[model samples]
Target: MFSRKTRLAVAIAAACSFNQALAAEQEQLELDAQTVVGSADESAVDSYRSTPSSAATKLDLTPRQTPQSISTLTRAQLDDFHLDSVNDALKMATGIQVQEVETDRTYYTARGFDITNFQYDGIGIPFVYGNVEGDIDTAVFERVEVIRGANGLMSGTGNPSATINFVRKRPTATPQARIDLTGGSWDKRRIDADVSGALTAAGNIRGRAVYAHENKNSYLDRYSREKNVFHGVLEFDLSDSTLFSIGHTLQKSDSNSPLWGALPLNFSDGSKTDYSRSTSTSADWAYWDVQENRTFAELAHDLGNGWQAKAVVTHVKKEGDGSLFYVYGTPDRDSGLGLFSYPSEYQDENRQLIGDLQLNGAFALGGRQHDAVLGASWSRSELEDISWYDTTTGTALPPLEDWSGNIGKPLNDAGSNGSDFTDRMQSFYGAARWSLTDRLSLITGARVVDVESSGGNYGSDKTTKYSGEVVPYAGVVFDLTEQYSVYASYTEVFDPQTETDASGSRLAPVEGVNYEAGIKGELFDDRVNLALAVFRTEQDNVAEMAGMVGGRSYYRAVEGLTSEGYELEISGELLPGLQAMAGYTFVDITDANDDHAVTYSPKHMFKAATTYRVPGLEQLKVGASLNWQDEVYNGIAEQDAYAVVNLMASYDIDPNWTVSANLNNLTDEKYLTSLYWTQAYYAAPRNASMSVSWKY
Candidate 1:
């Protein structure tokens, strides 16, 4: 795997050199991507609706033209709601569920499956292993784009749920600067600053910088956090048709008394135990610290023949250190004497590198114009962990009625070992959009992947490899009228597994298929967009645990696990000064036996947010958002259906000044973020924040 990636890197370098030479000799052509920015098909910053998307097929197609579901969180929307974290921003996106399983570990799901494919500016490889640790701030992102369904064209692992792409903020042709100061509930305080403009005369060279600092205490006892973020970028226009861009980002978060695991919700009697939202099971000596450094470079060239060549390279380093304590065992309701504490100290470091090269352009076929794209990409991730055990590995704790975050710091009393591993993927992919007729079109793409993983987890030796696996995609769209289109598509993804069969033989990789159809409409002169989509996903070769053999567990391949659902979404300006977005989603999951499966995922969800500029007083805008979902059950516990309301109001003091406020969970709803696990933490209660900003 390593040698193959080395060869791929050399090939990409050669392609970059050729692209640079061609760019220097050719005249500049009309290039929408002269720099790192969103395409014209992207939704504007001031509107809630999007026009077109390239995240799925790499071909610019309007929502009405693309045979899939899409959602976008624009800069305007982010600022309006003060969505400071990536997790917070996704809460407003349609069909998304943010599972906050721990203070630092989170899982995101869409359409009844985990979303493992993440991208930056359309380049893949993010959050390896399907979990978000620590915090991911949104200060440096210009917009967040979501494609809800299988996307095998760009991602190596095409999860049959969704793909998230973050577009970074870039230097602008005109100079601009902004500063923001905010204070919120839970003793939260933050400041952010951003500036972007030219670095030299004639605007041939440009740069942008962003910085943010935050300090806050959580509603939970013994929990607080401090964070700092910085990002800087430089753009060099070597030639009129060529752009070379490089950027670096650093984000660090220090959390005190972070929760390694959640508290059990039930006692030994199988009855529920109610706990206050502020209750915690962390020790005063517990702390978790995380830091990440990211660097990326991009080169784009317009080939003068309407063809464009682009190359992107990204590298990331993340480190986590913590001393944690976990309390386990169902306590006796009468005496609260059954719980025990398990303590440990640990550190981990992860590194990831990815590179891609691609060419896209228009070609003539039978005297008709068509769009095509060819690309290759390679990515590798490595992780190393070191740890030491504690003094209270199995010590019983005090009674629950007197429980508090009071524990002694252990002195490396237990032994520890190293756990190191690596994951690699290399793929070549292509796609084309054929305008078969003026009103009908066909879009097709496929990706061939090479994947491998070798590592030791704790004390277990694991290795998996797959060579030359092909994932296919197909879609077609028929425009019934200038304002409406109907489309259908078949998409697929492959997920390698390590589970072995009862015969001690490795099972085949899991295969996923998605069948989808939808109708989309663009009305009111492209100001409003609406869509209704129905989708069903089938997964096969899923490993199911069989009876233990020789004191070890073996598995058998199971198929027929399926999920089907429909979604309705509408977004845009409903009135001259009113911008709104609303969506409804329904999903049903069943196993091979036709019994409910993954019931933790709500079958029905409705999310809506709208802001209205007061009549004749455009400077004053007020809005409210509501998220409602049906009851959820995880085979162990159940959470009743609930709703959360959030309110926002902002006023423009002047052209250069503004003040805003936000109130969350207005109903103070008490509910778990998820019931996917027997032990889950409660979501936050009512909270408010106020902010002021200045622009120049």
Candidate 2:
């Protein structure tokens, strides 16, 4: 067995040696390739172009013309960073944090709140079992957009954190194909392919298909995963000004690892340091598995009368089975004393159906200018939860190392615990944008939601349906110059509690309001986009107790909680052959009712990356990045801070082929990726990967 510090040192050394070797190899290859092709057309710059910034646009407007703070991760950025999932894509974004909640699950937070409000191609996808197991793949996306603050006018229900929207890749009228293969440490292997082209004469119809497969192992014992994703889309042009598109995606993940909880924060006598990294207290547990299927259809038509109507329908089904295990007790208070363990086996199933309709265009009001939008949406979700417990077990399970050789047998004909049940939600909303002047705009929106929950044999009793407030929003954008703009906005969001009140009725919804102000600029031929924003969000009238309960389930709210933050983002091709992206955030989250700083929000977080092509080496590119955060407290006891670096180099083998390598966590810092005192998840050890890609 290796000590934590020893392991960290070894990983760092390996990463450094690997990167050195790769750099040498890439340089040699670049020299050989340039000799053969004589550095063909170094000034061919057609590949870089600014598409619409999906993040800033509310109605398909360009980023410079929009009124808010939006950050976008382009496909080039994704490839440079070797991003394989949504978690990987947002890792270095401003104001965003990714925390590994379990071996196969991750949580994303923005501005001190969980950002579970996700949109696929501008449409909301219903999710359950938290945000960890949702069926989303980075392979099918062209870019990812993050809108900082509330977006009630677009998404009906959500938190005030941030909204993450995935923009799917669209088929071009011309034919194209790409294939990529990657291999790295831990026997990791990945394959991704994309094919798109016109499917009919006159280019009236176009279609695309994307596929990805990944298999990998982790440093932890008996921890591994395999995943597959497939996506398809079809687009048809009804007329010059009208278009229609439809798409669907399927994702499945299989893992051979159980949920591992956090570790202790301190040793005896209130010492700050405690626990060994390799100490696993439960090795007899089986792994958990999740399967998800989703399908959707959308239609957009421009009436040619300055009006457009869009409709969307989506369906999702998800299922899971396995055991979840965790350790519980006061560690320092009872040093060297083994605490109680929680182990449970269960199965879950969820299904959802949603529909949305919207109409947008321009209207004249008192000879002024007005761009208005009206929309309505409804969704229904059904959940079935089942579990079985072993009553003969002792209060404490054997240490993880001790059980390694004595794998426990599955309980035969396990006793059954009745099922738990819950239904979905229904909502309607409308919004409009009014341009008071050519340089000023005002936006307003509102929504109404109704929700209900029903109990089963082992779940809570039935709760009658309840309605929530007509949430409202207003915003103003003032253009100081052609290249500069200032904006301020305020929006409200509400989430209805599924539990019953004193009279056996659904409780009132928790209401949250977000206020934000920001400035935007476009410099250097619209190549650089810069934004700075300050925001404050407040949530009131929250339920007291809601979350995973007794291995069962529960719900509650933190009454009067506030999260405030400042953020800055810069993204673009800074120079002809140089491109850079960076983001920084400072947050102050507090429990307003108690006047205490929240436990998980880090005060300072920042990420920056730069990629440059060598002045005369047209065939080679090199990039590096740094991500850092200030100390964050764990359960009012322990605190930890971390900084990590990444490096990459790529060489064009020919017009049709390229080779690249990436070194992740270049310094191998030993730190907890997630913690709740007594429970901790370590960051990934340094790893290296080499990839070969071909395009035609």
Model 2, TM vs. native:
0.86
On lDDT, the candidate that comes out on top is 1
Q: Candidate 2 on 593-665: residue-level lDDT in tens?
A: 5565546668899998878888888779999988899887645354567888999999988987999999999
Residue 89's lDDT in candidate 2: 80
* Candidate models: Cα lDDT each: 0.82, 0.68
Q: What is every candidate's alpha-carbon RMSD to the true fold?
A: 8.2, 9.0
TM-score of each: 0.91, 0.86
For candidate 2, which ten residues in a row score worst on lDDT? 31-40
TM-score of 1: 0.91
